[model samples]
Target: MIAEMAHLDVVVPPEIVDNETSGETTVEEGNSVTLTCKARGYPMPVVSWRREDNLKIVLRDQGNKKVTVTEGDQLRLTRVKRSDMGPYLCIAKNGIPPSVSKRIMLRVNFAPVLEVPVHMIGSPLGKEVTVRCKVESSPRAVATWRKEPGEQMIISSHKYNVTEYKEGFYVTQMSLTIRNFTLEDAITYRCVASNSLGATASSVQVYEIQPQKTRTSTKNDGDDSRLGNQIPLAASDHDKNDLDDFYNELDDPINNYLDPYHPGGILDNDRDREPLLKDPDIPKSPTGSKTFPYLNGGGGEGAVGIGSRWWWWAWVVVVVFWSVVLPGRVAF
Candidate 1:
């Protein structure tokens, strides 16, 4: 072993082979897909896979258990789902100064799905209201608004405003606005979505709410009697005291001065007596007329008048004279 020293060991960073790896792939839902990543280095590079968004990878072969990283040069997905549609990253490293990564995009196609946020919407008459529906699909579905019962397509105009908003790569919000909503517009409307995969529809009901009616009450002659009867039900203590004072004043002898024929003297007969003052306990009618209590009845009907009591006493005296005094004279 005479002369020269030979070098055998070498180190190299990992580099992904572009021709052997997958960049972007599109497949239908429920189909199988495979992603391959090949890398080379002085020492054999270890290959691993992960999601570009750092989300977990679902392993269908391993009882659908989720994992952050999978060790393999080839990623196999059987029976792909829509949730598997996203960007994936393949990493290669073997104790190298810089690791290598390859981005692979996965797309899964599915049928159109329709969702109605509010199935029933109410708007006041001559007001504006909007009906909304959400759609999710790959390949960008075509959305349309159609009035039910006839399936007439809605066009963008002053009466009906149709609009679409993009919420995500595959999610869109569809809306139909009705200006000056009326009774005729209160019907079921359909939101239809169609794509190359499939077509779907959802319904929304629009209803017109009548404007609230305002009621006002006024004092009228026709309602005077009913209203007068209700006053006693709500009478307060102060009103009762005022009524008592009024009745006492009516009973005073000084009020007899108002009678021209019986001034300062007692009434000779009940027929000649009359009420000289209005009763204060009774309520006045809406027509500015006062109500009075009954004069001849008592014990719940009304208070008895002074003239009615006098009449009863005079009748008793006459009966006694006819039965006792005249009968005794004739017998003697």
Candidate 2:
């Protein structure tokens, strides 16, 4: 009897934490859930909860107040999302060398939803345009492109090109490219994103490009320096009279020397050389108004001098003509 009792004295190691992952606990979005976790051991282990993937656990209280619980049991989520489909950890510890934990996966199913950034899109003629439709669903959605009032599916063709591109984890983009868009391509196009759950659509208004008005730039007459292509306008009667007067005055060489101060008389210095009783301005020059250099001593610069400042006027005209004609002539 003593030998048989010795076998009953064998000590049993502590039991690791055990979590229940039973029958399908699939829950739809916008539903409540209460997952329970319990563990039995020699030391009466303590139970806790966490995300197995190290993500944050979102929970709600009685009043539907959102609370982020990092360390706790019974992860009660008021409204669940498809992201809550991942695994969660239920931990138990009782002075055990290695703590025990269990993983419970929550599955949530949702329908497809689609949205386009803009309702209206425009493209010019002879240009290619792309329309993007964003889709979101638990199961990957199959996007179909077509025009309004026609539920038929679109296939890859010469003019139209349909392609699917995933933008983010849950967001996918459906693009329809139309090459050389014209008035026929400018219509209300529809995109339908469908999954096992349901289907959704987004309408895009493609507007026909209107003819741009040809702008005729107005020429500003005041801008003279940059007006290389400026056309001359018809002169008025007053302009004609002024032009005729200018030509008539230029015809008389004597009028070129008219001075404001000495209107009808020779210059004072000129009068000193040869005094005249009559005015020089009155169409008829006084007798002996002409001063011939040969009559006087004509050799040097002073030899060719006139009675008044007429010599300087002639010198200025010669200098102007030489400077304009021989601009490249180097002077030593």
Candidate 3:
């Protein structure tokens, strides 16, 4: 029993740490990169990623102008650039002592690419037209069609209509149908295709209508007579002038009160009632001189009576007076 007096010591194994985790596993130039410091410990250890030289782990991409960083006991590099790439340390501590973690790597990839294509189809009156717009891209695209002048295109029940299709990654189609087309049916059509990157448009197609036949009628003697009968008898040139003069007199306040025949009797009543003058050789006065009896009242071309033979000098007096004084304001 004296052999049990000696004492012995036993060694224990280190506890397993947290699963490795990297903050912002992927990053872009001019973007902030955050590395997560997740570690395991018996009492939950504190974790952090630090630069070896104790210098800031930040890098500036002047060209891209971005920053990068991380959370959870990790280092954040803001506006990250190619220069920011280097070994980083992760430290963990449960108060027993601080422990560092393995470094994590982050890589950034470029964005997706996209493109579109323009397409067109022509149409005419009373006809159907087809058009297709195409799109090509790294991630595929979408295409659509609509009428220009107005949003919706009305298809006639009689014969025309439209059909649309969007299927494969590369192509799309739209069809326009026109029935019993008339000149009014002519119009321009357009198509459009687009993707995440950009959009494109097709050219306008103008529709033209065909011409139609027409008939015209000819005139005959009997037809002419019938038309003549249809016209009112009082619508003759003389009647027209009389009516016009009546209306003219109404409009002229200064002459409205004047009698159609007497017109204020500026000339004798016999001279005033005379008909319109006609071209004739000037008659010599009874006194045989060009200097005939001058009438004082003014107005031009009057005779003594409608049918009576009167001295031409009497009318000459009126003509000369009208020419000299009435031009400024011919009341009627």
Candidate 4:
């Protein structure tokens, strides 16, 4: 007898239900929003919610706990902000060979906000200057430059240039450049931003400032002569007289003071000069010993002292007399 085959159920892959699930949603800031995702599959598929960018999802209901993936068919957000605007993913899986996911975009609308980087700008005359402001809003804002007091609208022209740069989906950089800045351009300018939600404005003031000055240094002839005339501390009166004599000798060409063969030249004068040992300028000590003036620091005199040579001559004569007379006596 053959047993009957057990009943078997067919396995099925997960499929997202588009009609029963939420699609693209738009809400204002500080408001609450809900996204629902439903799916059908065998073995009951599990539904999960996550950000398309893989960023943590904020849960306001559970004390603002942030989580990467939340298990449910519904994703609820309270007091939504502009940062919460992006694509979200709803995934469905049941341990099947194929899983399914749906993309839902969230857009949060907000009023136009303006931020001025510099409130006051100073520029030199006849030069160009640029002033910039930052704008943040949803549904791109119409930005403009307006001069205060008169409320005159400024447009791109030869005298002024208006520019805009989109830094992000909700951030724009607005700039106004003034060519050949002059006194007329020195005034309070306002940056105005308006959108479908609201409008905002900020101000910038331009003023004329003096250009930086460069300094130069110069030397005077009198100052140079004064510095040259100042004498050194170690120079003595004798040194000054010698320097003067040298200059005088140079002026008198007839003297030929530097000539080696001349009668009155440096060589002849040095040869005829009295020796320091025999000179009477050196003073005698209390013991009758000749003392050197420069060595003792007692006098700033003509030259360094040389003691007497009488003792040297006496020794030479004594040796000669002893050798001659004693040798003669021994021979006799």
Give the residue spans of candidate 1 off by over 4 A: 1-8, 214-332
The number of the candidate with the highest TM-score is 4
lDDT of 3 by residue, 95-193 (tens): 554445565555532222222233333345566544334433222334444567773544435555556555432334555455565556555555555
Compared to the true structure, candidate 1 yields what TM-score? 0.60
Query: Which whole-number lDDT from 0 to 100 does residue 321 have in model 4?
Result: 82
Alpha-carbon TM-score of each model against the true structure: 0.60, 0.52, 0.24, 0.65
Which 10-residue window in model 1 sums to the lowest lDDT?
Answer: 297-306
Model 2 Cα lDDT, one tens digit per residue, 21-113: 332366778887877676677566677777666776766455544334444445677788877766777777777547777777776768888
Task: Estimate the lDDT of model 2.
Answer: 0.67
- Cα RMSD of predicted structure 3: 22.2
Ordered from best to worst lDDT, the candidate numbers read: 4, 1, 2, 3
Lowest lDDT 10-residue stretch of candidate 2: 294-303
TM-score-based ranking, best first?
4, 1, 2, 3
lDDT (Cα atoms) of all candidates against the true structure: 0.81, 0.67, 0.48, 0.83
Model 4 C-alpha lDDT per residue in residues 223-331, reported as the tens digit of each score: 8778999985566877888999999878554333223335654435655432433456544345334344334333433333333456645776899889997899999
Q: Pick the candidate with the highest lDDT.
A: 4
